[model samples]
Target: MATEVSSRLFYHFLGALKRTHSFSNFSFPLGLPQTSMSYSASKTWISPQTKELETWTKIRDSIMRISPRSPFIPKTFADWLEHRLAIKEDQLRKVVRKIARISGRDDRQETTIHPVLGVKEIEDRRALVLARETIWRQSLESFPGRRLAPWPSYEEYKHEGDDRSKSGYRRFLPLPRDPGNVTVNWKQRKPLPQYLFDEVGRRTTVDNEEDKEPGLDELLAMEFVGASLILLLDS
Candidate 1:
């Protein structure tokens, strides 16, 4: 994760390159200005770009004092940080909107409106809640018939004189004395699909760095897996 200090430092370096240029024997690949004087003799104050760079440098230094990570690499960290800021800003706006709604001070009428939008806030909220509840009930009711829990008393396979009276498989058996249903096994958890398991194992374990074991993408996907994304599957 990128810190605030490193991002500011990177931008400050950009501003600094823009300022304090020497006209004598000057060269710039990034299109920097070639100035007649490095520093103005008339004023003790620095140029606007230089001042901006200095201000950001001070702020960066202050943030670094609090942040723990060091040896910052600007390219990867700063670029990722800009993306993270956008995600965070969107989240913050949602929070502010929720707060505004709660306080009865929401500015719903004044803000920019989408041309084809159909639903209002309260309607959207109600619809979302209803949809979530419906999904929850559907999941609970839609138990996979073959997935019996692995209990101490229950047999994975049928035994001689084993009572089939209470067995779900026996009740749902299409034919009398169906040995195919009798031999079939049941599991508790919804096992990952063949492809998903293969992908997850390869991405998280086999393809990852051997010493480090797992990399960013695999770790992120594993950590952020919400229960809602999971579905019933065979082992």
Candidate 2:
């Protein structure tokens, strides 16, 4: 599920990246144009949960170091890339404060408050989640009978590396539903619009063989898009 979600997000990320001209601006692209971006245990043995959190951390920290305290809205892919990379440490601290306030729990305690689903940051977070789900749905429709995994909950990834420590660990509020009910009803799920399916299909080989990995371009697109999605939701 994690793999599927990330891959789908990457698929969208590539389109946005291209539209923003992110690839052309960089002197050297993050991943080779021909390299596979699909999730592969052989590429990196880390768990998807840990890898995603780590990727978010890396992109955020890297952006904070390079971006200004008050950055501008990106006008191009390069600009967007730069903007996405520019995160502030204080912004993260502020999220902690907001989560604490909403959950009525001390920051020091483990929280189950889903970071992106609550009312305070509802709009942006909700959009991010929906965007992911939308992409996943389209992928399912594009290649019928594919055995893609389910998307993990926003709450599940909230504490990816927290080990219940008081010093560095952070927790969030859980989703307001029975875990069993959270699963999607396959029969009732909606597919991506035909136009989008056609566009995305023409853009990349999203309908690859079940066992084959995505090509390099698809993988690279996901990396930037996936990281951007994380930051956007966090914001």
Candidate 3:
């Protein structure tokens, strides 16, 4: 792919030279096949042209780095290019908008809106209790078919006459016929602090008799997880 592009550019340069005074320096006639020329003659014309084309290709690629199609263009380079060209903010924004529309691209600056996280403290104890209860009930009720059953048992029969009621096989089945429902025994916990720092302090306090005090590392980890859980539940 690269070789083909270079060859095309070289030929185009040669065509452009036909109109200029530099055409005579290219020793061979344009009409003749390149194979017909001596190695030295072809080398004389091709080498300089190849070098010139490579330089031009490098310059073109540098310019193209600012283009939306170039996948690997760095942000710093793009910024530098815009500054060097004295591009206005509006012009740049317009270019970005057009590129986004054409390529279905999402520019973080224009497209992304980060959600604002605000922790609203639960002032009412009743509300928190209700929420906990609702969540627990929902979890328990979600799987209606789940039930506890006894393990199967089996016993050998002595004779055919001993299987009078034909209940010998019944021993192999689960003993209990009734389906046991799920129950959640939610232990009431002391209220968390209105402020996050107070909550962390309270959790780490060895003086509190109602709850077990965690180690320093464990307290920090619990605080982090608790904060995340509160945010998730609130949302």
Candidate 4:
């Protein structure tokens, strides 16, 4: 099932790559008549062209990052799609910013009169979240007739089975009962040392006491050597 999903994702990614590659050959008609149009109209036209340039620059950067020869390629197809979705979301944000600037409106507004046209940061985030959810659902759909079960609460799990000692909480199964589950008793053989529970400061004090200190004889020998050096300097 995993292999089948992987193959499908691989082909889908290849198709996307082909489409992105084709975009490189396509050029936008930016050569408009400067004299025929008013200053405001020309400004409106130039803004889109500028946006396109920025889009292409971003695309080029993405291409460089996800190059075939690059070592840091996404491990899974979902990850690759997520990367593309992030790029699209960024483009959407730029569009939203441009629209806000043109309309003289604050970008903080969550929603507007027009649902499709009026996109704000919050809406973009919501859309991104929805897109991620959709991707995850689609991936899960590969396993036919198998839906993920919700996690059981502690109270529910504890009282699941009749037998308290042998079943229920003792024989707790976190996953679906497909593969066999093994139960192992992780009992300790020996008791822990009493010093293990000692306070950090106490432990440090003990360590300091255990460490060998400089002898009094060694200190006197160093003092004598210092005196001899002083006498030689005087001479």
Candidate 5:
């Protein structure tokens, strides 16, 4: 009975989604669906969970294509993304300060915070995480590594130096990179300093009490938007 409902939602999802999804046929000018975007996994028949996944995947993918720069960006995600970016910017500035201080260079005003760089990072991260969390929640709610696929095993790749005796099957375990890892742009030749990834002992760095922060109204607004998150999930 549950499978019947799931199947219905999945079919409706396909019809409703064709128009809005980032991975839809229209998204690719070449008329090719994205490599990992298709719903079919095994046989012609999809299971109940796969149906639920397809339904949620369509919805999540639809929301991700929305642009903050667009005139019609939904208010809630924008508010959340904006607030997150502001918080991250503050953190990035502190990192830049530490890097500058450690370089034996006097803290020049320009190096303190590059406004353009901060804006670029915030925009990029906002888009990526918005896509990420949308997909993550969808997949996690549905269940992972089943019906769809599992992480590839070590036997999937061949390396010259690896020894099967000592390495055992452990060498075959998938070592996936984190999607949120800092991406270095070789074309721009911009490198984030190493300290950014370094572990800080138990000591917590706190901003001075006198430092100004964005008003309560701003944080209140983001929280207010978050309160309506169910609507977003359903949308």
Candidate 6:
């Protein structure tokens, strides 16, 4: 599932990069048949990156505002792509924070407390959960029905090279000695939407006796139906 999700995201990212590159090269033709001031007045230059960011923000907002009861769902390929992008953005934020902490560049500790779900919210979530389970079961029973291998237990995994004192296995590895010369400006990167993050957290925390909600990538792999439903319900 992880491999599948990664491959899908990789293609999406590649296509986005290509689009950005193509848009950057776009410009008005040098020779216009009509010498009208309207052309010059309408000439507005927006960086491809800026345009991309704006488009992303709009999509993210639209997805986040969707209600669970709405018939509109991420059933189409395009809708799923947008959903995947939103999940990817959230994952990127997590990765950035983790890297910053590992490099001793971030020290702030923040706690988030989500509000309790209302009666209507609970019913909506239950409906979504049922939908998710149906999809998941169908996927499992599809052609070439083969069970996946169980993940290795902590005791079975090797930890010989790990630094026991550190939180992570690779924490002992040194970072670049000259950190001031970094090329990428991390601060310039857009952050995950707060509402999206909150929604993801809320949905993932929903408990079920038969099957627990999976991680974001797993949800993406399962292609759960519903608009903004991707992040609206918890694993």
Q: Per-residue lDDT for 1-235 in model 2, tens only? A: 6445544454444434323322322232234233345665344233333333344445555667777364553333334333333333334567678888989956697867775335543222112532432333312332343233345454344444343334476654332222233355432344323323223434445565775665545554666679677567769
Q: Write the per-residue lDDT of candidate 4 for residues 1-235, one digit (tens) a residue.
A: 6545644554454444323433333445545432335655633333323333444555555767778466565544455545555565565677679888988976688874675435633322222432322212213331333343334435435544434545434654433222212231112112222221121343233356547554444444556668677567759
Report the number of clashing residue pairs per model: 0, 13, 0, 0, 1, 5
Worst 10 residues of 6 by lDDT: 173-182
Q: Give the TM-score of candidate 3.
A: 0.12
| Cα misplacement distance, residue 89 of candidate 4 (Å) | 0.6
lDDT winner among the candidates? Answer: 6
Instruction: Flag clash pairs in model 3.
Output: none
Please give the RMSD to the true structure for each candidate, in Å.
23.0, 28.2, 25.6, 30.2, 29.1, 28.0
The TM-score of predicted model 4 comes to 0.18
Mind giving the per-residue lDDT tens digits that candidate 5 earns over 1-235?
A: 6445544544454443323223222221323233343576533433333443444444445767755355543344334334334445565677678888899775575556566435644321222432221222223332232122233334433431265435664454333322232343222322222221132353435577556453444444555567477456758
Which candidate, 1 or 4, would have the higher lDDT against the true structure?
A: 4
**Residue 93 CA displacement from its true place in model 6, Å:** 1.4
lDDT by residue (1-235, candidate 1, tens digit) is 3466746654454443433333323222433343444455642433444443444444455656766365542234354446434545565677679888889966576887774335533322212432221212213232333232233223433431244545533432211121233335443323323212224335434544656564545554555663345322211
Model 2 C-alpha RMSD to native = 28.2
On lDDT, the stronger of 2 and 3 is: 2
Which stretches of candidate 4 lie above 4 Å from their native place? 1-71, 105-235
Query: How accurate locally is residue 15 in candidate 3, as Cα lDDT from 0 to 100?
Result: 50
Full-model lDDT, candidate 1: 0.41
Candidate 6's C-alpha lDDT? Answer: 0.44
Query: In model 4, what lDDT does residue 77 have?
Result: 41
